[model samples]
Target: MSQAKKIMNDPENLVDETLDGLVAISNGLLAREPGSRVVRSTKIEQGKVGLLVGGGSGHEPMYGAFVGPGLANASVSGDIFAAPAPQHVQEAIEAADAGAGVLIVYGNYAGDVMNFDMGAETAEEDSDIESKTVLVRDDVATDDYEGRRGIGGAFYVVKAAGAACAKGMSLEEAAEVTERVQYNTRTIGVAVRAGILPDTGKRTFELGDDEMEIGLGMHGEVGVERSKMMTADEVAKKMVDMVADDLPYESGDRVAVYINNLGATTQMELLIVYRKVAELLAERGLKVERTDIGAHFTSQDMAGFSLTLLKLTDEIAELIDAPCESVPFTQG
Candidate 1:
């Protein structure tokens, strides 16, 4: 088989090199922990609850890019599609610790749960810094709610917790807000094609020209169903219907919509999807308080997108509107 073509000094150095580049270009906004894959903010507000997040390397601007003011104070990264080591997670926990406490936000993947949990235990045992966690499980395709995998809806969870911290909320308060965000969100994704694995230089999954997979995972995990391709509007209605009905979002309720690109899909295509989403919501008399469309989370080179909706209460809406500064996301 032909080796995969990647622009890099060495595949082994990809993660480290990427971290170095990110910090250098951050304009003093970020710093790297010595000899570790953890990256943290250079400025942490005193006496506020610190927010920490982490995951593998392939999903750029995700667990890492979202670290900054009004967001995560630090983030830990592992190898592509691999969970960070417990020690790496611990470093982030330590970096995010303010006098108040720290809150760890991450996906519901098994490895992430185990490592972050271990890191929290280690921090308490060593330094007595109180830490808590909120696991994001927004994918609606899975029947096992507790075991549902986290995906695009993670953005809402981070935003809620970060804002709570920014408001000087206690650790318990921040954690409660984050949990509320997690429960009030739902996401569903479809893939027209699979992504290529950098290590192997091959597609993670195979799809025919006329086929699409619904509820596909970020890491190429099996989806719930496969069928012939549908029009952009048809796909939009199908996904939005599933997500909306699951939450039983009422006609008078407002929501925040996030349309995320998986990897290789064009912005024009994503916009087309969003247009249909907007129209469908209007038809249902559901108000769109906010809408975000772009490639926030991705499966490396995967050709598809996911839709996330956050059912909004006054508190959640206010928190979502709060200011945030991060590498990939910033708002007033």
Candidate 2:
């Protein structure tokens, strides 16, 4: 019944303003096209398979923050909770294109799929630049695996693909690695609170004070179940079980345990969740190869966390170890 408090000056300019901030903070590592919304990395190497990731703007540090050496070559953003236009997507493709080919990665949202597909087609039609698409459907909140939403789990998918390209893999090969990682990854999230939509200035979803959402998506859609609040260990146990069982990760499988803060969940809270997650994985004999306990893909101001299990084959592990440098993220 009241205006949602937002710090931005205008909702209409939020996306562009956000891009401006990203470019500024990047300190010469990233740049925005002249009068265009495509944010490209200034550090893209010459003659490698171009890597591009695009989606709506609300999920900060994802699809955009991912641009740099060893990650996405470019990223295009749409308005708040919306997909980028085809033209913008095409511009991103052009920015990413360095001759070999381009590999497009995004969540399985229909708008993203359509826009990215059209963008790829336009690139080929206009400039003869070949490209491939890898759709991420790693969220196991739904029974239909193929129809699942791409959540925080997409981070590793991008990492693997970017590393593959950085390692001199072909477009087709990098695309394959991207898809393989997507399939091997699974995620499940729980939100104890909702995020505010800058466009609407309202909470993305509603929850009673004593309630928590299970299997919540980044978009703030109602989760699969709503239950009274649970302790950190209880929540972690429930979420870890759901994610691990859906992927059917076995006793001997090596995995990277990722704990993603939806938006506002605190460090202390997530680390506690990770503790139980790690203990559970050990009990199941699943080898923990790495643990990523921080924000990768976030929904603005949403107080929750998502757990991602990236089953690491030797290949995925090697790719994960490759060096990458982005303003907000860097790894080796």
Candidate 3:
């Protein structure tokens, strides 16, 4: 097979250049930290909790794009699919500090955990900037909830945390809100085709033309099962069943449904999936308080989608509905 196509100046300069482009188009909302890969919001308010989220680069409009009002105050990015260096994370922690302390949020990956933890320690020791962390572990495919890998459900975590911080909640209160959101969220994804790693320019994994991998990780990690491609309705049923069952959602329970495009999946397909999800939820007498559909979290051109369900309480629902603005997620 022929190699995948990527457009860029140089593979080495990809992340930096992308940041430059994002800042340029941000209308002064985003600024890059000198000598580091960290991006910060230009409008962070003093005495409000600062939110910092970082991770590998390939997931566009995620860690970085999420830096704005009612979301992360800053974001640190590593090379594609790689964790940022500890020093980089520390720099973000320091920059995000605004006298109210900073909260570091990211996927529950081992490398991210280690690096961010070190960054928090550095900030506390050197800058006296108190830092806390909220690790998102919402993927239900894993048996270990505490150690479960974070997925698209990170959106809810960031949303709730950002809203709390914007409302002038204390750093501790914001962190608690974030943890609450994480606990109530769950996500599962299926991959119809694998994505190509930017540096290597090769597919992360191979999938048959007529097959799909269910419960696949964003980085193409092995999932629970791989089988023939099912109809959209069938796939939606399976995905919703797995996610809803895990949460043990019952009749009359309210939720926020997020249908995320893995990468190459089109909006049309996502809507089709959402339709099925909505139908299934309705069948179960579950109420969808809000719905977000788009490529909020992606795997770099991978053709698939993920279903994220946030079982909502009154407070959680209010947070998700709070006004926010970012490149990918925006609410009035």
Q: What TM-score fits each model?
A: 0.97, 0.98, 0.98
**Looking at model 1, how many pairs of residues clash?**
0
RMSD of 3: 1.0
Model 3, 1-332: lDDT tens digits are 88678988789988998899888888898899555699999889888999999899998878778988988899999999888999999999887888899988999999999999988898899999998899988888887788789889988888898898888988888889889899999999998999998778989889999999998887899999899989999999999989999978899999999988889998888888888899999999999989888787789989998899999999998888889877667788
Which segments of model 1 are wrong by more than 4 Å?
1-4
Candidate 1 clash pair list: none
- What C-alpha lDDT does candidate 3 achieve relative to the native structure? 0.89
Model 1: worst 10 consecutive residues (lDDT sum): 1-10
Full-model lDDT, candidate 2: 0.89
- To one decimal, what is the Cα RMSD in angstroms of model 2 from the true structure? 1.1
Q: In order, how many clashes per candidate?
A: 0, 0, 0
Mark the regions of model 3 whose C-alpha exceeds 4 Å error after superposition: none
Ranking by lDDT: 1, 2, 3
- In angstroms, the error of model 2 at 69 is 0.4
- Arranged by TM-score with the best first, the candidates are 3, 2, 1
Model 3: lDDT of residue 231: 93
